[model samples]
Target chain A: MKVLNEMSVNFESRSVNEAFARTAAAAFAAQLDPTVAELNEIRTAVSEAVTNCVVHAYRDTIGIISMNIRIAEGNILIVKIRDRGCGIEDIPRAMEPLFTTSPEDERAGLGFAVMQSFTDKLTVRSKPGKGTTVTLEKRLSPRLSDV
Target chain B: MLLKPKTMFDGKVLTVYLSGDIDHHSARRIREYTDALIGELKPVRLLLNYSAVSFMDSSGIGLIMGRYRMMKLYGGSVSVVSIPPALRKMMELSGLGCLDVLEGGNEENESA
Candidate 1:
């Protein structure tokens, strides 16, 4: 797929940055002229991805979380969030709804589920002891103004 | 930024007014504060007002689930009120709606 526009950002894997990451993604996706619902979905997906990096990936210490946003052809918005911390041992199990590693922390384990529900496509690539990368893709609805 | 939740407690019910974004960062603080109140008040019912919540994700689900568990331990029940339309899908996806925690239907209740 041809990329129309792209932006990359790296920030500390802190919970506070979760809002920043998602808001930045939404701002970047605004070029697609997404509806309110589309914009909200993107923000929620990005928040879940970044929160994973902060809570699960870098559980014990602070680390760097890198996010890349791209607008691909056909008005598709692609978001990539990466963390160079403790990676997932089993991607499939981790993605299961309500399967949280940190139950003690009151995590409902709905992060992956929410992302999947909100986005058009969800991809996870990880290696234990290496890192994790989550890619979210959503096709924006074509607006009448665009037509 | 942490949005402090406003709480009102009658003898039998505790209402928590939650606003702004409910993400991991904010959820932690809110959980801690609200849990303390639940421990102290021990209301028969816990009502969470989401009329002003602008954004939420899975963290919001976690918050509700945690509160539900807490209330259950105290022989109390939990219900959500005034969920914004934007967050209705999230509540549905998390099966909170199935649990009947959504006080009224999915309609946005501004006056709540």
Candidate 2:
């Protein structure tokens, strides 16, 4: 699949950045002319991925979070959020619904579950003492106004 | 919009009306404020009004679930009111419907 356009942004691993990441992803996907519902789903998925970086990845320290968004094959919106923080030990268990490592923060352990449910495709890669990367893809339908 | 949670206590029930967006950052603040109030007021019922909430992600699930657990421990119950369809769907996806009552189907009298 040939890529149409791509953009990358880096932000600090801060809890507040969760909203910024979501808005940035939504704004980038806006050019695709996605529907309101589609846009919302994309934002939510982005929020979950970024929040995971701030909460679980760099639990006690601050780090850098990189997000790359791309449009592929004219209709597929791909987003990759990467963090240089503590990597996941078990990917399968982390993806399970309500399986959270930080219960004191009231984390429902639904971050990965929500991302998987909202996006068309969700992938995660990580290494201990390194970091974690999450890639999400969604096929967008053009908005009527842009058509 | 700046994140803020509006809290009100109607003698028996403490109504928390949340506006703007609910994410990890704001959820923590909301949890702290609501937990303090719930602990002090000790209301028999807790009503969470999310009608004004514009955007919410999975962080909301933790917020609601934490409050539910808090109320349950106090021998009280929690009810969610005026949840928009999209947020309601997200909550349902997290299996919250089976735990707490989703208000709005019946008439709600805030003054009651």
> Estimated TM-score per prediction?
0.96, 0.94
Which regions in candidate 2 have their CA more than 4 angstroms from the true location? A143-147, B1-4, B104-112
Q: Which tens-of-lDDT digit does each residue in A1-147 have in candidate 1?
A: 999899999999988999999999999999899999999999999999999999999997999999999998889999999999999999999999989999998888999999999999999999999999999999999887675
Model 2 C-alpha lDDT per residue in residues B46-69, reported as the tens digit of each score: 998887788999888899999999
Query: Measured against the native two-chain assembly using Cα atoms, what DockQ does each of the candidate structures obtain, in the order listed?
Result: 0.91, 0.83
Which ranges in model 1 have alpha carbons more than 4 Å from their true place?
A: B1-3, B105-112
Give the per-residue Cα lDDT of candidate 1 at A130. 94
Model 2 / residue B46 / CA error / Å:
0.2
Clashing pairs in 2: none
Local distance difference test values of all predictions, in order: 0.91, 0.88
Error of 1 at B7 (Å): 1.5
Candidate 1 chain A weakest lDDT stretch, 10 residues:
A138-147
Question: Model 1 clash pairs?
Answer: none
Tens-place lDDT per residue, model 1, B37-105, is: 999988999999888899998889999988998899998999998888899899889888777777774
